[model samples]
Target: MACLSRHRHHHHHHHHHRAWLTSPDPDMLHHRPLSAHHRPLPHDDALPPLLRTPHPPRLRHGRHRPHPRPQFDGPDPIWDAVRQEAKREVVQFNSLCASVASIAFLVFHFNCVQAEKEPILSSFLYASILAHDCLEQALVFVLANRLQNPTLLATQLLDIFSNVVLHHKPIQRSIRLDVQAFKDRDPACLSYCSALLYMKGFHALQVYRIAHALWHQGRKVLALALQSRVSEVFGVDIHPAAKIGEGILLDHGTGVVIGETAIVGNRVSLLHGVTLGGTGKEIGDRHPKVGEGALIGASATILGNITIGEGAMIAAGSLVLKDVPPHSIAAGIPAKVICGLQEHDPSLTMKHDATKDFFTHVATNFRDEMPNG
Candidate 1:
């Protein structure tokens, strides 16, 4: 009877070990043997492999492999290069202006000493140069010179204009490009210093940029005020709301008038007495959209929501009311398409001979003379 009891006990121990190995509950693997009521049912080897094995969260490749690191982090190289180039240009331009001012001071001082007179002009030059050490300071000085009134002192005006220029980086860049545009396009502009010091067009454009900034910031009263002063002083009446791109050449810019909603594209050349205006009492986007690299000759009047296409040329005194196609010449009153453009950008070439080209084409094509009556 004792032997039979021992055999029964061993049989029960073997059955429990088998049940633990083949259990469906993975928790059973980690825990100590459960109480009789809490024990899990035994599973068979015939159960599916997925049911038998628990899958932990995993990396995509495999458990042993590691993820790769990124090659770069931060600003892109192309943008970095562009920003660096702009900075270099600004520094070079400022240095050139300073050098020119120094030379002028020396020349004026020597002349005064030779003549045995008070160095009045030399003193003014020195003071001006001392007051304006950089382009932003110079621009503020110019604006203050014109815009200061009984209510506003030059210093007060300087502070306001300085804040607008210093706080906005794009305005500074635009100023640099504007200087470059003058040097590139205007044969009369001997250097960047000449443009900075003497070009009224450059002065007008920079002031307009400040006013435009004010307009965007909801200082409409101040913006309009600046606009009025600019028109009064420079004779260039560009509305504060007008959008003008970089590298614009407002050559001999006096009497130039850009309307409220006008949009002028990059590298455009507008000569004296040009009017980008509305027709009669019309309002709401009633101004021309002048495209990139276009040339508007002296006194050209482009009116009322018309698109002056890229690289198109408007002859002097032409009245443009319709959309001029890209790379074409529009001439005459109620301007007609005189001829297709041969040059890529007549503005850059500084050519105002569209009428000559038109006449030449007509002469060449119309071989038969007018029928002899």
Candidate 2:
């Protein structure tokens, strides 16, 4: 049976390939299974045209060359920050210096304006001449020192003292105040220039200021030398160690003597022949301390370590040995407080005369103090 009927059958196996590669539709690629070993590459059509296309090689001397890296020619950010900070600091410092200079200039200008208001300085030409005179006087002082020493010390004295008295802040302020005081307080003072030039009191005070500075700076010999010159020329013997305050008016300056330890307060007025001295040869703070705005008349002598109270008026030729109360009138030998002041600032008024009421009060007190005879 097997030899008579023999039949044969064949089974065919086909491998599946990606259909999208040959087909027109690319959407069919997603339906096909991917291989585990490889990922699907993005098609050139998925990217923008500019990025999809390859750049052509550059030709230099008929050879292909690649593009070069870009360079930066700008300043560094950190350096720029540092430079800006430095510039800011410089501006701040400059502004500070300018402010200081402006203040100093304004003060000087104010003083000049005050001077110009006076009759003597009303004319600009007169003011200029006065300025010239002041300069000449200053030069004379410098020249005198130079002739005496002929050394570096003498040569630099002018510059040194000028800087201290004129440019120095505190001293300059004191000087301005003094000039204003002279103009306001003295009837004879015509202008600032006159006070600066011809006023022996002012000259003596200024010389004393320089000497005071020299004394404190350990230049004792120079300080004493200046004191001697002041005594000789101005006839106002103010010891360098005397602590005199600003706005002092030493009227008629001659015979005005301030002791070594005397303390004269601000706005105090001293008429000619006023003496602030110690009793006998007493040492160590024996000199009087005159309070502010006190008026000491001509030939009035304040002795020992007495405190002449503020706004006290000591009559001319009075001898003050004890403390005088404030705002009171002290007159006569060994000076007694005769009456209370209706006006406190006798210094400002420059008043020295005794009123009729004052004389009556004094006589009444004298009669009462006298014993029965």
Which candidate achieves the best lDDT against the true structure? 1
The collision pairs in model 1 are none
For residues 194-269, write the lDDT of model 2, one tens digit per residue.
Answer: 5654688876777787788878888888888878877876788988999998777888899998999999988889
Best by TM-score: 1
Candidate no. 1 TM-score: 0.65
Model-by-model lDDT, in order? 0.64, 0.58
**Model 2: per-residue Cα lDDT at residue 315:** 89
Q: Model 1 scores what on Cα lDDT?
A: 0.64
**Predicted candidate 1, C-alpha RMSD:** 30.8
Report the lDDT tens digits of candidate 1 across residue range 1-373.
0100000011112122211112222211122343444223224232222112121212223341121111222222221222222222232333223333212311012232332343243323222332222455555655665567766666566657877886676676577667667877899876555576578888899989999999999999999988888888789999999999877899988999999999998778999999999998977989999998899999999999999999999998889999999999998788999778988877778888658866566566676566756
